[model samples]
Target: MSRSYRTVHIRDFHDDDLDGIVVLWEAVHNAVIRPVYSLAEVIASCQEDHAVVAVDGDQVVGAAVGRAAHAQGWVVFFGVSAADADGQIAADLLDALERRMAPLGLAKLSVLVAEHDGRVAALAGNGFGMRHTLRYLERPMPVQRRELDVLGDVGGRILPRHLWEAVAGMSAEKRLLEERLVTPLAHPELAERFGVMPPRAVMLFGPPGTGKTTFAKAVASRLGWPFVELFPSRLGDTAGGMAAALRATFERIGSLEHAVVFIDEVEEIASRRRGDPPSPTQGVTNELLKLVADFRDGSGRLLICATNFVRALDAAFLRHGRFDYVIPIGLPDAAARAAIWGRYVPASVDIDLADLVDRSDGLTPADIEYAARRASQEALARALRTDGGDAEPLGLADYVDALAATRATVSDESARDFLADIEAYGRL
Candidate 1:
């Protein structure tokens, strides 16, 4: 039986496939294959250098040759047979080659493809940024610098650039933040013309699983500022207790040129005070109030505080002058749920998204994400257990099943209370 060349499998080149590889090179390049490497040289490359081939049964249809030196690497040779010029085969060959070379800690991998080569499109599709003929392409590796010290001092971390875009939906909330917080910080001059002083601090209030923390990080990312999450619990064990640690953290934050300090579940330390023998956290709350006042006086910084129960917070904490805006991040609406669902489910899968979205009413973003993941996991397990037949794609039925078994993180009562809180306290 003739070997089928349809199912391309990418693997390391073998000694026995020399003739097929040579034929593939000749067939693809034709006149361009001048001074081709000898069989001995090719064999040596396969044995020593990073090399991979796309094969179908016994036939070699594509090859990629890569070599790494010090902190740099180069794709020296890449060719695919004319008969098998599909972009998928070329992409597979490149994928295999890159996987083999990635562990070498090479700083950069470059390929010099001809201007008119059809493979250029394929390379671009695989994340190879283009450069003009006269210009050189360069990408600098991220290096940790002294500026990051402030983040460490305050128990903070830098968020990735994509986090802002990764926030699936919440158009109204995102827009409000962008206008009330992001716009003033990003374009101060424009804000000044509108009599808008850049926001110094804001409060994010909602139910537990409503993505308040994620929104805080996203805000920092959008402004290209460092994210410093002050953990009150972690500070409680410090030398001076939570109040002293909180003061010291702010002092350290004051040193940085720019920052977005976040404190999640802030009500823990800033809860309403009672008469006579005040709460143990009263002193801590007083210290925090002073810190917020001091922090607001400084420029180039924004403080974000998140709370599950806004009513539990001290009235002074939510006063008009203290917090510029008190935004509410509630459960995902139908449109928001659809967007979140789209993010978790593979686009290739055929499912009734509208039905799923309708069924996911009152679900938080975290809840939807968990349900979608569960559906995917269940589908994957079923596919693995199947013996021979092509596995069925995860459909609406699978997701519905997962949804039935998944517990909603936020209960209806909690959601109603959150709505009430927003009505009573929401500012933006």
Candidate 2:
């Protein structure tokens, strides 16, 4: 007997839906119409690509999977159970999948189906029209095998997509970076038409815990390139001296096709040179300066260096032609503070968000995160200590207590010093 359901709900595809999808695929295959995508392809897209499913209680009745390539979106899989063949499940799944992929800025969505597929009616009902028939094409990925080896050797990785959007607040910083860095890099041809040269290297300076490193990674993620972090301390681990090690590392980095190389706490190696006998880091600093000059000569790469103390850097290092921009990343502003707090606060908790934001005024993003986590810990402890299991949602009192106990990372003096540095050394 065919089963009937009273209601069907569409949702994101979960790992547990694997079995249901397999059954659906088999049913479609047995009906004399094979899907253009193989089972393996569909399964991979279901996991790694964007997908949505229609579920009736515990049963997955339908699914749609999609993959975005450049400006096009491809439907990798679309199927529904035999019982719901004439129902609205298929349309719902496709709509949900499109909604999930809407943020990718796709210009069009297209799908391939067998010439004699029986489900064409459902697609037509959903506003899809028949376009010119063409043979499907396949090719290897853009990153070749040799490039993978080079990336692994240099300890580089491709960050997840959409990290730029994930960065909550700091609209001013985001806007500046987007215009100065991302726009030119992402649209080099457009930039060239207006007599703009994409920046090759930039420096981010601020007090500790100001999220300079986060912005660097987010830039790499936004550019869809490999992120490689060069550690000054680790350079000493090799057989040669730190200077030689630094040179060798850059030589290896030169082989990669594209990369975003980052060096944090650059003040450690690029500090001012002094004394009659020149410091040990003087050699390393000289090597780094030369490396930066060479790294700029190439294309398809960006170098981001961050430091807590911008004033400690060698004066020559800040000269023109070396770094394109010397941007300051200060503590969280009012709007940023509110966004950071909202990210950590639980939805079930009933706390005054504006009050928390007001109290966190001079705090860094890291400082706010610490206080929020501390608040949760205290709330859990309180619930455990009360008798009769007197459990209640976390309140403003818990967060206020945590805030009082938390030590702010950036002091008033340091905040003033940052402002001074911005005035003296800031370049955009």
lDDT of 2 at 112: 88
Put down candidate 1 lDDT per residue, 1-428, tens digits, no spaces: 01223687788878787788677655645444442343545556777888888787788888888878799987767788666555777777887888889999988888766545666777888878887764334432222366676667676676786777887778888889899999999899999999999999999999989889989999998887888888888989999789999998899889888889999999999999896898899999999999999999999899999999899999999998899999999887777888899889898997788999999998888888889999999989889888656888788888999899889888889988988998999998
- Global fold similarity of model 2 (TM-score): 0.69
Distance from true position, residue 164, model 1, in Å? 2.3
Question: Which regions in candidate 1 have their CA more than 4 angstroms from the true location?
Answer: 1-146, 384-393
On a 0 to 100 scale, what is the lDDT of residue 374 in model 2? 95
In model 1, the worst 10-residue window by lDDT is: 135-144
lDDT of 1 at 135: 38
Clashing pairs in 1: none
Worst 10 residues of 2 by lDDT: 1-10
Best candidate, TM-score-wise?
Answer: 2
User: What lDDT does the true structure give each of the candidates?
Assistant: 0.83, 0.87
State residue 28's C-alpha deviation in candidate 2, in Å: 36
